[model samples]
Each structure stands twice: as structure tokens, then as C-alpha cells.
Target: MKLRILGCSGGIGGDRRTTSILIDEDILIDCGTGVGNLSVEEMRKLRHVFLTHTHLDHIATLPLLVDTLFNDLHDRPLVIHALEESMEIIKQHIFNWQIWPDFFELPDKSRPSIEFQAMSAGETRELQGRTIEMIPVNHSVPGVGYRIQNDTGSFAFSGDTTTNDTLWEVLNRHDGLDMLVIECAFSNSEKQLSDLAGHYCPETLIADMSKLRHRPRVFITHLKPGEEDQTFQEITEGLRGFDVVRLHSEDHFQL
Candidate 1:
């Protein structure tokens, strides 16, 4: 399995992008602003997108991608799987006719380019040669992260979570997790805010990492832009026993 980090920043600026990751060439973990970096051909090849939450930084580019690639769909709908609440937010706030033309209904409602499939936590959805499961995480909204495995390799991503037990329990149950793409959105100094927002700071994140039975090559993601260096430093310094590193756009890992 090839994991491509499309974007891994919490906020955007020049050279900084919001969170998104592409699994192989067919599945996208989130369609943040980073999706805009993909070439037209890459855009056309997308078949499945697993959303983390309803946050704009996580799913902002999905609507735009569907709109831009509308004509190229060729009756192929972009299947987006996420928590039912996440889908509801997209439909009500993003894909609503006025906010953006509902790609799920444009050209033709029956043959639209985007389709939202509600996935509840703990549900495993298999497609092609892969198994992708949605699992709960501690986030402000009703959000779930994804753990995907193919015959060859496995990877799990903790989507915008703070600290949680079910995530670790689920990972232990799967037992094949090779890489963990989790988020640490704030520096250790901003622990209060991080907790308030239901995101991980280095301190909280380190504690959470202790729950894992196996030490996967942990790739840290979703740090707010300006805080990158400090957050990275804290995470590296604080997490002395783990293999954690910040992720960036276009970085690829072949597992």
C-alpha cells in the first residue's frame, strides 16, 4: 500500500496546507485544500474518499473537486464514506444549493458525480482488495478515524482526536497496524486550548500513544501552521520512546 500525504497542516497559508492523505491512487482520506494540488488526471482517478470529520480543514476541497471534475465522472460517482453526522454537515452546510452547487445533484441527481455513504463507527466496509473500517476517536463532533488494510499492509489514521481509549482498543484488536497517522494540533504550551478544541497537544498525544501495543512508524499530522517548529520540537522531545515525525504534502510511504 502506498500512502501519500497530500497536506498535513492544521491551518493554511503559503506552502502550508490542511490535512488530506491519499491511499494508493483510488482512495483519499480527506479532501482538504491539499486536494487542489493534484493534477487533473489524479483528480479523475479518485474513486473513494473517507472523510475524518466535518471540519472545513479536513473536507473543504471535496465539493470543489467534484465540481471541477464533473464532466469527467463518466457516470462514476465519487464515493465518500464517513460518520453519518459528518455527511449531514456536508449536505447542510457545504453541498447545499446556495453554498455550492450540490455535486450529488448536479448535471443529474440520479447520475451525479459525488455520493455520500454514511458509515457508522466500528463498521468495516470492504472494496476491491481493501478493508476500511471507521472507528471512534475523541473529537468535538461525532467523528471517526479510519483503519485500512490490504493483503500486504495496514495503516490507521486518528482523525483530529485528543485522547481516547476506543481507538487504542480497536488498533489492538486489528493487530496489523504498521503506520499511525495521528494528529497533534498544538504545542505543549497550548494544552488548555487543545483540550478545549478536542485536539491533541504534545503532552496529551504522548500519553495516548502509550496505549499502543506495537510501535508503528508514527507519522504526526495536522499541526497548526505557525506552530509547526515548536510543536514538532515538543512532540519529538516529549515522545522520547516513539518514532514520530511530522508529515508534509507529497510525502509518500510504501508499506
Candidate 2:
């Protein structure tokens, strides 16, 4: 499987985009502002979107994406896989016509342009050959992480979480993990704020890292734009034994 880091930032600024990850050509983990970087042709290839939550930074471009491909989606609608609660929040707030046209009912209900498939934690779904499993996570809103694996290799993504045992426990249950895309959104100085906002600072993230058993190549993501240097410096200092790398937009991996 091939993974591309479309975006990975706590906030956006010049050249900085919120969280979004493209898996191969057909699947996306989140549809953040980074998704805007894709060409119309690239967007057409997308068939599945697995959302971590209903946060604006994560789902900002979803409405636009569906509207842009309205014509093409009539035949093969885009499938949005997310937690039931997250799906509800999106339906009531974003797609309620007041905000944007409800693509779930657009072009007629029977042949809509988009479909929402409510997913529960611990459940797994296989599309083509990839097995995608949803794992519960601690966040300001109802959220989940994902573990995707195929015959060749496997990987996990900690989707907008703070210090949580569920993520580590689920990952340890598996035999092997090739890569781990986790978040440390703030610096040690902002530990209090990070905790309140349901995000990880370097200190909190380091403490939780002890729970994981596998030694995958860790990629630190979602660092606040201005605090990126300080947060990553602390992570590098604390996680000395682990092979951790700072994840950047456009980074690609083949597993």
C-alpha cells in the first residue's frame, strides 16, 4: 500500500495545512484543506473517505469535494465512513442545506452523490484488499483512530487524540506495525492547554509512548505551526531510542 501525507499541521498558515492523508489513489483518511491541493483528476479517483471526527480542520473540504464531483458521483457515489456521532454532527451542522446542500440526498435520494456509512469502534471493513479497523480515541469530540493492513504490511494513525490507552492497547494487540502516524500538537510549555483541548504536548505524548510494544517508524504529526520546532525538539529528546521522524506534508510511504 502507498500512503501520502497530504497535510499534517495543528493549524494552517502559509503552506501549512490541517490533517489529511491520502491512501493510494482511491482512499483518504481525512479531507482537510490539504485535499484542495489535489487536481480535479486526482479528486475523481477518490472513492472512500474515513473520517476521524467532525472537527472543522478535518472535514473542512468534504462538502466542497462532493459538490465538485457531483456529476461523476451520480454513478459511483463517494462513501464517507465515520463514527455514528460524528456523522450526525456533520449531517445536522454542515450538510443541512443551510450550510451546504445535503449530498446524501442530492441528485435524488436513491441515487445520491455521497453516502454516509456509520462505523463503530472495534469494527473493521475491507475495501478491495485493505482491511481498515476503527479504534476509539480520546478527543474533544467523539473520535477514532484507524489501523489499516493488507497482505504486504500494516500501519496505524492516531487521529486527533490526547493521552489514551485504547490506542496503544489496540496497536499492541496486532503482531506487527510498519508505521505509526501520531500527533503531538503542542510544546511542553503548553501542556495544560493541550490536555484541555484533547491534544498531546511533547511531555504527555512521551509518557503515553511507553505503552506501545511495537517498534514502528514513528512519524510525529499535527504540531502547531509556530511551535513546531520546540515540540519536535522535545519529542526527539524524550524518544531517543525510537526511530521517530517529523512528518511533513507531501511525505510518501510504500508498505
Number of backbone collisions per candidate: 0, 0
Give each model's whole-structure lDDT.
0.88, 0.94
Candidate 2 lDDT (Cα, whole model)? 0.94
What is the Å distance of residue 45 in model 2 from its true position? 0.6
lDDT of each residue in 1-255, candidate 2, tens digit only = 999999999889988888899998999999899898889999999999999998999999999999999999998999999999999999999999999998889899999999889899999999889999999999999999999999899999999999899999999999999999999999999999999999999888999999999999999999998999999999999885689999999999999
Candidate 1, residues 13-75, lDDT tens digits: the string is: 898888889888889998888898899999888999999898889888888888888887748
Badly placed stretches (over 4 Å) of model 1 are: none
Pick by TM-score: which candidate is best?
2
**TM-scores vs. true structure, each candidate:** 0.97, 0.99
Off by over 4 Å in 2: none
- Residue 243, candidate 2: Cα error in Å is 0.7
Best by lDDT: 2
RMSD of each: 1.1, 0.7
